[model samples]
Target: MKIVIIGAGAMGSLFGGRLAQAGEEVWLLDVWEEHVAAIRAHGLTLVDTAAETSIRLNATTQADAVGQADLVIIFVKAYATQAAARTAAGLLGPATTVLTLQNGLGNAETLAKVLGAERVAVGTTAMGATLLGPGRIKCGGHGPTHIGSFSGGATPRLHDIATIFTRAGIPTVVDNNANALVWGKLIINVGINAITALTGIPNGQVMANAETRELVRLAVAEAEAVARASGISLPAADYFDQVAAVAQATRDNRSSMLQDVTHRRRTEIDAINGAIVAAGQRLGIPTPVNETLTLLVKTLEKTYLV
Candidate 1:
């Protein structure tokens, strides 16, 4: 399979490196010149519990250089989905499957608008990764990746992508309920991300403390309520408990939002908690906790340069 990774960030590097190692023709297309240059000079360095391995692959900033990919997996930030979709034009062949494993909501929709709904698919991945530097990433854990068509039901391409991803050591499942998969991940991020970003705490401390745990519960409850109102089929009924379990499982790790705030990079608050708040307003549901979290995170972002 010929694959093009759109963002080439931490998660993107992990999936692309593994797929390339599995003998797929993979190309990483990112605007980060240094990262692209490093991968072109030396191979992409992947670090895991087993060992650090340098995986050789194609990488370029110019999408025209890697024309017509079989699969284009979007790993860009949620806010940058529109831009990424526009940039994806060079890589879209007639049969190209554009899968968004991105965070939060509306990403797949944004892609659908530009690339056509029939070609776009929605999904989520449980694998975690962190960018160490140019051409280097630490994959914290491996987990199942779920994929499905945007309009619902299983497609042959979904199964084909799942097979390729699973064969490359990234276990993937073809789930027909795309809404459930996306909302399931969004609910987790809603609980952990903003709390960790504001408190400068790891996942363990977020749930371990009585006070912060309450905050997480309230925020998650708000998101769950909004999901219910929106008719999104959530994967589990007990979202707070699910979020707590995820935090406990990855106790020591810092959330992606925390990393963003720590580094003064823009966080994905608008897509995560903010998305819930927006939906709440649209559905006439009060999401005070999530709205407050969204406002607080936005305020934090405003102060990044101050």
Candidate 2:
């Protein structure tokens, strides 16, 4: 199957490089001219805990290069989702599947509005990847990827994709309730990512600090209420345990939010915490903690941008 991966940063390059190395026809599309040029010249590099390898694949900066594909995996930032979807419209066929493995909520919904709901799938990846340089990614953590249809429909293609990842040594699972899984990840991110970003600390530090741990619990509790009000079943009591588990797994790793903050780039705070606040408003639930976090991040973003 022909596959196209939008945004060749970290996660996108890791997955695209693996698929290409596995002898699949994969194309990496990005707007970054320098990165695309580097990939086109020297191939994409994948640096993981196991080994560092490079795979030659078609990389382009033009969206028109995103021709018809059986699957299109979008890895753009949350704020750039619409633009990426619109550019990737050329890659859509009648049976094409568009899957988004983005963080937080509403990404699937946004893609569904651009592409049809029947053609859209949502997923969350626990795979940790950091951009080492142009056309290079350092993969750190190991975890399973979960994917499924967001419209509550069963698709055999999801299983096919999961099998492909499994063959490439990336564990994957297909679930009927991907939205719930996404919400679960959102709960964890709400608790962990922002705290790390604000404190400039790793997961271990946040979990080890008594005051920060309580603050994380408060944030997760608020996010849990928002999720429950929106008809999502997320038990708050077990949610903290899940957060602690992530802390243990990636103890020394900085979260994507913290990385973004350090790089002076915008964080996914809108799609993460801001999503909870929006959902709370729609469901008549209060999300003061999430609101406060979102506002603070936005304020910080403005300061850095200026």
Error of 2 at 26 (Å): 1.6
Q: What lDDT tens digits, residue by residue, belong to model 1 across residues 237-260?
A: 899998887787667677888878
Q: Number of clashing pairs, model 2?
A: 0
User: Residue 200, candidate 1: how far off, in angstroms?
Assistant: 2.3
Off by more than 4 A, model 2: 235-237
- TM-score to true structure, per model: 0.96, 0.94
The 10 consecutive residues of candidate 1 with the worst lDDT sum are 245-254
Pull out the clashing pairs in model 2: none
